[model samples]
Target chain A: MKAKPKQSRYLTLVLILGLIAACTPPAEKTAEPTSIVEADPLPSWNDGPRKEAIISFVEDVTDSASPNFIPVADRIATFDNDGTLWSEQPIYFQFFFALDRVKALAAEHPEWKNKQPYKAVLENDMPTLMQQGEHGLLEIVMSTHAGNTTDEFDSLVRSWIDTAQHPVKKRRYTELVFQPMLELLDFLRANDFKTFIVSGGGIEFMRPWVEGVYGIPKDQVVGSSIQTEYDYNNGKPIIKRLAKIDLIDDKEGKPIGINRYIGRKPVFAAGNSDGDLQMLRWTDANPLMSFQLYIHHTDSLREWAYDRDSHIGKFDIGLDEAIEKGWTVIDMQTDWKIIYPFEKNQ
Target chain B: MKAKPKQSRYLTLVLILGLIAACTPPAEKTAEPTSIVEADPLPSWNDGPRKEAIISFVEDVTDSASPNFIPVADRIATFDNDGTLWSEQPIYFQFFFALDRVKALAAEHPEWKNKQPYKAVLENDMPTLMQQGEHGLLEIVMSTHAGNTTDEFDSLVRSWIDTAQHPVKKRRYTELVFQPMLELLDFLRANDFKTFIVSGGGIEFMRPWVEGVYGIPKDQVVGSSIQTEYDYNNGKPIIKRLAKIDLIDDKEGKPIGINRYIGRKPVFAAGNSDGDLQMLRWTDANPLMSFQLYIHHTDSLREWAYDRDSHIGKFDIGLDEAIEKGWTVIDMQTDWKIIYPFEKNQ
Candidate 1:
C-alpha cells in the first residue's frame, strides 16, 4: 500500500544506517565484532579484557578499510619460547637437557667426576651448580654441547625431546606448552602473520622439536647459538658445533636477534620475563599499530607461578613497563580457560 | 552390425590406450606435458638441454608418484644473488656501493685521502685498491658500513639504489638483474619451491631492495653480516651496526650460512662462481633428487662475459665441477633469450 518513492527512501535510510553501524567503533557497538564471527580462534582464551584486546587489535590491523590496517607481509609476530609459550619453572628446559647430557657423558670422561661444575652436574648438586654461576653454566654447556657434528647434535636433541620428562610435572617437556598461547599463535598465523620463536635457549636444541610442538619451522626460530665450523669429515660435509658463543637471544639481544634473523620489526611480541623488556619496548615502539603481550604467571594451582623474583624468568621490570604502557597483560589464571593442552581432556 | 559384447570390449580397449598415453614420458609423448599447460614459465630461458633438465627435475621431484618426490616444505631452492641473479661485471655491485660510500664520506674525513684503500677509492685507482687487497677492502667497508643505526644504513642503501646508476650501463643497479633468473625464481616458486638468496654481499645492503628486485624476502636472504648492538639512544630503541665481521656467506661459508639461515639443505642451488662451489655441493649431496645449476657467463654482447680468470665471480672450480657432475650449465649467450628485464621493452 506504500508509495514507490516512500518505499525507496525507506530502503535508502536502512542501508545508510547499516553502513554507519558497520563503521561505528567496536566499543560503541552492541553486536559482536566481525573478528568474532568465525568460531572462536582463541577458544582456550577465556572471554576477558586480554582476549578482547587481542581480537580487536588483530581485526583493526587486518581490516583493509581501517586506518590501523597493516599489510600482511608486515605482520610479523615474535614469541618467547620459555615461560611465555611453555613452563620454565624448574629451570629452562635447555639447561635440564644440558645437565642430563653431562650425566650421560660422564662415563666417557672420568675426569668430569672430579671437575667442579661437571662433578656438581654428575652428583645432581643444584646448590653447588648454582654457586658456580654463569661461568659454571657455560662450562657445563660447552662440555656437553660441543665436539659433535650438527647432525649428531640434532639427533641427540630430538631423542632427548622425545623421551625427557619434566622433573615435577612428570610430563613430556613439549606437553607443558601453554594451550592459550598456542591458540594465540594459530590466530595470528590465520590472519597472515609470520610467527617466530625468539628464545634464549640453544637454537639447535629447539629446532629439532619446535616445528612439531609449536608449528614454527626451524628457520623461523631465533635463539642463542654456539659457533659452528664447516669441515669435511671423512670427505663428507659436516658442521661441527664449537664451544664458542655466537648470539644470545635474550635481554637487549632479543632486538638484535630480531634484526639479524627476521630483518623486520615485529608487529606483535609476547614474552614473560625482564629479559623480554627490550623486545617488548621495541615492539611497542614500532611505527605502526603494534601489540605487546606479556603473560603473567598467576596460575599457581594450574601451573608453577613464580615471577618478579624468580631465577629463571624474572618479570619485575617488564611487568611494571607493561602496566605503564597499557600493553596486554595476560593474567594466566583468569585469562586462560585451560593452562596446558592436556588439561582440556582432564 | 557388431555384437553388443564386442562393442563394449572395443570401448574398454580405447579407454586403456588413452590412460597409457596420458602416463607416457614427455620424450615419448606426442601431447604437451601438464606443466606446460599454463604458459611457458621460463619464456626467457631458450629451449635447450639446460632448460629441459630444470623443467624435468622440477616435475620429477614434485610428482607424487615419483620416488624422489619432495614435500613442499622441504622444497628449498637457494640462489647466489650477486652474479647468479644479477650481473657482477667490472666489480661486484656491493664493492661499487662501498667505494661510493667511501668517496661520499671522504669530505668528512680528510685523513681518508691519505689512507690506503680510502685514498685509492677517493682517487678512483682500481690498481692501487687491488694491490691493497682484502685487508684494505675490509678497512674501507668497516669505515663506511658501520657506526650507523641499521635503519639509517637501510635508508642510505634504499636511496642509493633508487638514484645510483651503473658505471658503464648507466642503468639502475636493480635493472641489471638477469631476466632469465627472475623467470626461473618465479617458475620455482610456482612449482612450490621456497626460493632464497644465499649471497656473499652484506645482508643489510641487500635487504633494502632485494624483495623489490628479486621477489625474495629479507628473511630468506642469507648473506655476510656485521655485528649490531641494541642500544637506547635518546630513550628510543636502536640497533647500531658495528664494524665486526659476523658471518661471511662465501666459499665454505656458503654451506654454513645456508645451514644457519634456512636450517635445511636446499633441493635446488644455482650460482655462477667458485664461491658457490660448496653451496652447490651441499645441495647436490642432499638425500633427495637435487638440481645444481651453474650460470656460465658466455654472453659478451648482451652482458659482460668472464669466467675462470676473472677476479670477480671467478667460475673456475664450479665450472669444472658442473661438467664433472653433469649439472645444468646455463650457457648465458645461447640459453638466455634476454639478459636483463629492461632489454625486453627494447
Candidate 2:
C-alpha cells in the first residue's frame, strides 16, 4: 500500500530515535532507578544518621558549585589501621606476630630460653611480659624484627601472614578486616579521595600486605619504623634493619607521621583509640569541611567490645573528644549489617 | 543517466569507508610522522645515543608483546634533585635558604652576633662557615630549621622562596631547573612511570615548591628530615619540628630512605653525584629490566661546571662507577642544546 508523505516522515523520525536510543548506555535511560537495583557505594553501612552524614558530606565536598567543595587533589582521607579497619580485641595483631616470631627464632637463640621477655613469650607467660611493660616489648620486637635485610624481612612477613590464624576466630588474619570500612574506602575513592593507612603497627610489616588486603598501596601506608642502614654485601645494595626505633607512630606520633608522609592535612580521618586522637584532632582543625569519625567498639556479640580500660586499643581520650566535638561516633553494634567479610555467607 | 549495479555498489563501499575514516582520530591515520610534526616527547633532548637509548628503553618496556614489558604499577622511577634536576653551583641551593633564614632570625638572639656559624652567616663570611664543617652546618640548620610547627614552617618557606634569588646567576631558584630533565620526567610519566624526587635536602623545604616547579607532588618527595612531635597548643593539634635529625638521606642513607618511604625498589634511577651512587646501585639491583642515568656537569659557559673537585655535589665515586657499570652518563655540554627552561626564549 502507498503511504502518504506525512506517514513516511513520521516513520523516518521513529527510526532516527531508535538508532539514538540504541547507542546510549542502558543505565542512562532512567533519571532514577528503584532502590533494589540502585548502586550502593556503601552497601554494608546500614541506614543511619552516621551513614547519612558521611554521604551528605562527600556529596557536598565533591559538588563543584557547593561552598564546601574541595579540589580532588586535596581530598585526602586517612584511616587508623588497628581497631578502626580491623579487629584489635585481645591485642594488636602485630603483637601476635612478634610473639610468634620469638617462638620461631628461639631455636637459634638458645639464650632466649633464659632471657626475661623471650622466656615469657616462649612460656606464654602474659603476666611476666606485662610486668616488664614497654622495655619487655622493645626487647622482643628488637630481637625478632631487626638484623635482616628489608627483602628478607618482607619475605618473612609474607610467609607468616599466609599461615597465621587468629587464635579465637580461627581465620586468616587478613580475613578479619571490617567489611563496612572496606566499602567506605571504595566509596571515598570513587568520589576522588586518596585514602591512606596511618597506623601504629610496623611500617615494613604492613607494607608487605596492605595492597592485597586493603587495596592501599605500600607507599600510601605510613606507620612506625625501625632504623635501617644501606650496605653492600657481595656487591649488591641492601637495606638492613637495625634494632633501634626510628619513629614510634603511636599516641601523639600519628599526626607527625601523617604530616611527614603525606605533607598535607587530611580532610577525613577515622580512628578507634586514643592513639588516633591527635590524628582526629588534626583533621578536625582543618579550615575546610572536614570529617572525623570514630569506630566505637560496642558489638560484644559480633565483635569484642572494650573501651577505656582495655589493654589494647584503649579508647578513652578519643571517645571523650569525639562526643564533645560532635564527631561521628559509629556504634558498630547497631550500624554494621556485617562485621567481617566472612559474615556475609553466615 | 543510469548507473550499473556494480558501479552503485562501489559508490556505497566508498561512502562506508569515508564514514569509518571520519570516526578515527587524525593521529591514527599515519603510523608515523617525520620530524616537523612528529611527537618528540623529550624535545629538550638533542638527537644522540643518549636520547635514542631512552626512547628505545621506554618503547621496549611499554610494549605489551615484548619480554621487557613492565606493568604500570611496577614502573617506578627515582630522580636525584640537587645536581641532576637543577643547578647545585655556588653551593647547594638549600644552604642559601638556610643562610637566609639565619640572617632573618639573627635579630632575635644577640648571642648569634658572636656564635661561629650564625656569626659567619650574618657576616657573609663563607670561609668561616666552611671552617665550622659538619658540626657548624648542623648548628646553623637546627637554629634556622627547627622549633616551629610544620604549617608555620611551610608558610615561612613559601614566603622565602617567592622572594629569594640565586646568589650568582640571580635567577629564581626554581627557574634554574634543567629543561632536559623536566622533559625526561614528562616522557617517563607518559609511559606510565611514577616518578619520585629522592633528595638529600630537607623534605619540608622541598615540599612547598616541588609541586609547582617539578610536577612531582609532595607525597612523592623523599628527603632528609628532623624529628617532629605532635602536640596540642591550646586545644589545637600541631606537629613541632625538633632539632634532632631523623634521617640524613645521603650516601648510604639514600637506599635506607627509599626503602622506608617507597617500600619498593625503583626500576629506573637518575643522579649526578656520589650521594646518589647507592640509590642507582639499589635500583640496578632490581630483578626487572632497569635504566640508570647520571648527568655529568660539562657545560662551563652556560652553567657552572664542577664535579670531583667541587665540595658541593662531588661526583668522584659515581662518575667512576657509571663508566665501569655501563650506565648512561649524560654529558651536559654536548647532550643538551639548552640548560634551563628560561633559556628557551633567549
Q: Of the candidates shown, which would achieve the greatest lDDT relative to the real structure?
A: 2
Model 1 residue A176 CA deviation in Å = 0.8
lDDT of 1 by residue, A119-178 (tens): 877876655665665566667778889989888998999999999997667789999999
i-RMS for every candidate (Å) is 15.6, 17.4
lDDT of 2 by residue, B1-346 (tens): 0112221111122122112222212111111122222688877677899989999999999999999998887788999888889987656777778878888888898899998868877887655665775567667778889999899999989998898997557778898899889989988998899899998888999999998888897888998888787778888778888887777777776787788788999989999988899899999999889999999998777775667845443578899999899999999888877788876665
Listed for each candidate, the true contacts retained, as a fraction, are 0.58, 0.75
Candidates, DockQ:
0.25, 0.30
| All candidates: TM-score | 0.88, 0.87
Question: lDDT of each model, Cα atoms only?
Answer: 0.78, 0.79
**Candidate 1 wrongly placed segments (more than 4 Å):** A1-38, B1-38
DockQ score of candidate 2?
Answer: 0.30
Candidates in order: C-alpha RMSD to true structure: 18.3, 20.5
Candidate 2: pairs in clash: none
In candidate 1, what are the lDDT values of residues B144-242, reduced to their tens digit?
899999889999899999999876677889998998899899989999999999988889999999988888888888988888888867558899988
